[model samples]
Target chain A: MSKTVEIRWHGRGGQGAKTAALLLADVAFKTGKYVQGFPEYGPERMGAPITAYNRISDQPLTVHSNIYEPDYVVVVDETLLESIDVTNGLKADGAIIINSQRPKEELLPLLNGYQGGVYVLDAREISIRALGKNFPNSPMLAATVAVSGVMGREDFLGEMRQSFQHKFAKKPEVIDGNMMALELAFNQVGC
Target chain B: MAIRERLSGNEAVAYAIKQINPDVMPAFPITPSTEIPQYVANYIANGEIDTEFIHVESEHSAMSATLGASAAGARALTATSSCGMALMWEELYVAASDRLPIVLALVNRALTGPININADHSDSMGARDSGWIQIYAESNQEVYDNFLQAFPIAEHKDVMLPVMICQDGFITSHGVENILLVEDDKVKEFVGEYEPEHYLLHPTEKMAVGPYAVSNYYMETKRAQRQAMLNAKQVILDMAAKFEQMTGRKYGFFEEYRMEDAEYAIVIIGSAAGTCKAAIEEIRATTGKKVGLLKIRVFRPFPEEEIAQALSHVKAVAIMDRSEMFAGSCGPLGAEVRAALFQAKSQAEVVNYFYGLGGRDITVQDFMQVYDNLENIANTHVVTGMYDYIGLRER
Candidate 1:
């Protein structure tokens, strides 16, 4: 109740990391709170190391910028951690949410001093099982909501469903599949 | 109550931007101009202004995003220095030729190699041929005021060309001063919401921008851009007059400081104009040498008529340029001034004095040297390189 959560997302260009951040902001906003979403651009070519950000506050958010120090990080792809210092600016209470096939012990070096929380879910597995492809952005977002406690799980899921229904309104199958992936990853994170 | 505040030129630009209330800004920071974007971003973050600050990857993207936003019928802005501007040179030409009505506050910086981050007009002079209307500001006040005037001048239907307000880096961009600013609503009322006749990316309307200007119509498109530049002369004056009416402040193609009844005159541009103005006053008071100063504000549309008119009575004209165009026969602005004055029938013996190259400090004492040299000049057809340091080769 005393925590103000700031989330950072790590992914490559063309991987929908920015969309994930914006979606988190949208959901957080619907909860009658303040939020901002943005991305940092550097040589914005495909497969380049990219980061997007989100901040949710019960009060109005004034600062709008790329998140340098984040409270919780949602890792869309485990491999990005090798090239990225995911815990570079994480607070002591900060947490890591990774879509990894490896165990948490293997990720300890990457998460080093981050002792607040860790939510390990094979987002690739849930994404493959639900969407039949390795689109891990939604699963990572679900894992983020679980580990961060920025919004209630049910409200977050409802907002995610509403977003998909609007964005993929022309395709009902895609919307349903994305919602299922959200739920599967949410459950896998054990929130 | 008049509020006296001392602020850097970057602060002045930011102050003017707040007054202009441009809806969209896209920029990347480069030295000297870096503080400007930083300040603008700060304003956006603090809820002090409502605008879209597009954090772009490079100056090219910054200009491209500005063009996109401006074409979307939103007032757009951006700033850059040397290589940043160079990177956007191609897009900059397109933005101008297409008449996008974007205003850029350029902090003039030297081009890299020997990698100096100091002040110079070399970067801006390099882009002089890019078809955008360029205005050189002499002080922090002028930097703030010129940009406030730039919007209406650029967005005018008659002149939709992008406008650049160049202030010398560190000298003007970082130097602090106090100047008056008009009320916010005053500027808003003067410029008004941009109702563009031709815009891009409107869903309900149809318009073509930067279409293929192939062999057949390339010449015509270029002609249209040139005509737009030509049309800007009257538009600038009209806007200045309106600015005067609303704010009691007026600016023109050039500000003449004691140019009347002088045998010798020094015509300079940018912040150096202030130093020259002081030198003119000092020289007139002590030496009574009848020295005058003509500060060129409007660089593009060349102000040929006004320049010729200002120098018509003067016996000699020394054009001081802070940039060296190695490819050119003379300093960039010097060449342009010569071309402008050449039209005069007086044969007023114009000399190109390449001074202050690479941001070498040019003080009133330096202008005094040029003044003394101009008085002693027995030869009319010659160029003088002044204040040359030992390592620097004088051309």
Candidate 2:
């Protein structure tokens, strides 16, 4: 458990929260770490709140259960903070990274007095400035990596660049936008 | 050298299918399992493998077409979950009785009554008596490995029965994890080719399949099927040995973790066994308790004697089931394991627990509590409750 890092994602359906979790796993795996990425699935519905999880460890992971006490919690959709307990069972020593433009003071109360270090990133701003669309998945993923220290910034960026090149091969321009979004988000989290 | 890759269980199984390049795959879409065929279809469309992909209207047709192809001396398979498997109920028996040796990639999910789509063993557990050789996986890697062995085990001359390779739906089927894949040429050589001795399309010999059997012949046919299942216990081990030699992973009828000197143990199947293993490690580390886990890999041949021998040293054992049998006493795994322990004349106090039914989550904490209960049971020698439920809410 000491070497393992668990993270949970809170997002609406189609927000790519699940995708972000998987990307984290993919990046972690590239660094030779064992990883698990999965979503708590339900009936398909648009804008419905969804949860996904990640377990990154140096040793091989055998546990298949949901993360009850995650070291970090990522809120992809800030509105989910009102409906879901985003900090439930979150470690106090760890932190919660939220994709919001709101000031920290406004969002802190919404966390039900969570004592964890709360880091805020304007993912919408970052994605819009970089990718010209509000695709928060990239920024949120980068923020989680920076906050959790699952991998160094250089390793994360290198792996993500290769993945984006492969994923967006047909549209070469989209790769730079995504990389920019990751960089903007990574630096904004102050890592 | 093994290829290091990350893939969901479905992807891993489909990758194996691509490597094996079976002759035919006739399948209909079902939740958690639809991705298996979808990936295969993508493979075929991309010219990666030339497997004949048949898009069927229903799971019934899926199984029927697969049976037809296999009987026609072609390697055939299909994938399904939950009600889709129920739809193929009739063909399940036909494939086994006719000895088609077809393989089925099953992602275990709950059957519909109230209508839910999540991970559970109700579907495969329902087909426990369908004459198919059932093998359950604890993770994506295990499912990939189990599927690689399915063809060799099913196609064995001594055990020519259909095999169902099962994994927890959405749990392993959808979750992405790190896995080591054997090289394609090695997989090709390992699975080899399916060459049936007798078939409907034989050039020289005339053959018939699924003919009407009277009561006298039917009984013997069933007995032969039983004998085939009994033979599978050995074939499974033999194939596992070969698989381990090719790769570095060792598999058996059941995996015994920390069981050598345990006073309390848990017998479980499927993905939750991984969670139980995590719990065992924590309990042993913190409390210095001798807790162990017996994760069953081969559920069909049951491995009765071996399981009893493995748990013989334990003072108490909790047999956990992810599916409810509605039999008033215990679930399917519990019943079979209790029977095995009984026949072996072991005095281990046993309690049956029904957990994770209908996609419910079983956490490590829940498992830790189960171990705590086992300790209490072993110490008191009084069974407060023999049949119980975990993660169940009280009214």
* All DockQ scores: 0.01, 0.91
Q: Which ten residues in a row have the lowest lDDT in candidate 1 chain A?
A: A59-68
lDDT of 1 by residue, A24-121 (tens): 77777777555656565454588887877776777533232235678888887778877778887787777888889889888877765577677788
Worst 10 residues of 1 chain B by lDDT: B383-392
Using TM-score as the measure, which candidate wins? 2
TM-score, cand. 1: 0.65
Instruction: Kindly report which residue stretches of model 1 are placed more than 4 angstroms away from their true locations once superposed.
Output: A1-191, B30-33, B378-395
The residue-by-residue lDDT of candidate 2 on A1-191, one tens digit each, is 35889999999999999999999989999999999999998777989999999999989999999889999999999999889999999999999999998999999999988997999999999999998999999999999999999999999999999998999989998999999999999999998
Q: List native contact recovery per candidate, as a fraction of 1.
A: 0.00, 0.88
Model 2 bad stretches (over 4 Å): B30-32
Interface CA root-mean-square deviation for model 1: 17.3
Q: Each model's TM-score?
A: 0.65, 0.99
